[model samples]
Target: MEEVAVASDGRALTVGSQQLAHSLFANYPLTAAFLSFALAQTLKVLTTWYKERRWDAKRLLGSGGMPSSHSAAVSALAVAIGFHDGPGSSSFAIALVLACVVMYDAFGVRLHAGRQAEVLNQIVFELPAEHPLADTRPLREPLGHTPPQVAAGAALGLIMAYLMHVTTNLSS
Candidate 1:
C-alpha cells in the first residue's frame, strides 16, 4: 500500500485504489502480515495437537512451533510490499531485508538460545534444594524455530500474501 500523507486541509491522504476505497481492512501489506501471523500461530495449535495427540491451546500464542509466526509475518509483509510497490521499489527492498534478517535470526541465534536454555534448565534441575541459584525459574525452551519450521512459515507467508494480492486486485 502507498504511504498515507497529510493533506493541506489536515485530512489523511491516501492514493485511491479499490482496496483503499472499499475494503474494511485498508492497509493491505500490514493486513497480510497480521493475517499470516495469526494463521501460523493457529496452525501451531493444530500441529501440536496432531503430534502430541492432545489439544494445546497455549500453542496459539507460543513461540517455536511447526511454523514460525515471526517468519510468516515478516515474509508476508515483504511479499505484500513487493506486490504493492514492485520488487524494485525501496519499500519492497526494506521489507525483504527485514524478512531475511528475521528468518536468519529465528533459525540461528534464537534456536541456539533455546537450546542453551534447555541445557541450563537441566543443570538447574540437578542442583541441590539449598543451592542459591537452584530456585530460579526455568528459562523458556521454545524461543526459536527449526529450519523446517522456518521454511514452512516462509511458504505460508508467500501463499497468504499472494492470496491477499489476488483478492485485492480482483476487487479492484
Candidate 2:
C-alpha cells in the first residue's frame, strides 16, 4: 500500500510507508552511521572467534565487547554529520557531544560496572556450598571497552564515514 515518488535527482523513494523512514535511509549520514555499527559488530564477532578459537554468534547482538559498538555508532554518526553538514553546524556539534558522552560512558561507568560484576562473580564462586547464592549464575562480563578499544572504535567510525562519503560521491 505504498506509493513511490521520484526525487529531483531521479531516485525513486517509497512514500506513504513508514512516513520519513525511507527518507532517513536516503540521508547519507544515517546510512553511514548504521553501516559503521554493523561493521563494528561484525568485527567484534571475528575478533572473538580469533581470540577464543570459537565462534560466538551471540556477539553479533552483545554489548561491551572490544572496539565498542556504542562508540563506533556514535562516532560514525558524528563524523557523518560533520561530513554531510559542515563541522561548524549545530547538528555536527550535537553529534560530537553525543559521541563523546557515549565513548566516555563506555570507558568509565560501564567499565567500572564490569569490574564490579567480576568481583561479585568471584565472591559467589568462593562462597560456601551451603550458601543459597552460590547456585546463582555468574554475571555477564565484558560490559565495557577499555580505552584502547574505544580509541580503535572511534578510529574505525571516522574511517568508515569518510569511506562511505567517498564511495557515495563516486557512485553519484
Most accurate candidate by TM-score: 1
lDDT of 1 by residue, 1-172 (tens): 5757565469987765654554537779999999999999999999998999999999998899899999999999999999998999989999999999999999999999999999999999999999998999999999999999999999999999999999999999
Best by lDDT: 1
lDDT tens readout by residue for model 2, 1-172: 7878788579997778775676767788888888888989999999998899999989999887777888888888899889888899999999999999999999999899999999999999999999999999999888988999899889889988999889878998
Alpha-carbon shift of residue 3 in model 2 (angstroms)? 11
What is the TM-score (0 to 1) of candidate 2?
0.87
Clashes of each: 0, 0
For model 1, the superposed segments whose C-alpha errors exceed 4 Å read 1-24
User: What would you estimate as the lDDT of candidate 2?
Assistant: 0.88
Worst 10 residues of 2 by lDDT: 17-26
Quantify all predictions' global Cα lDDT against the true fold: 0.92, 0.88
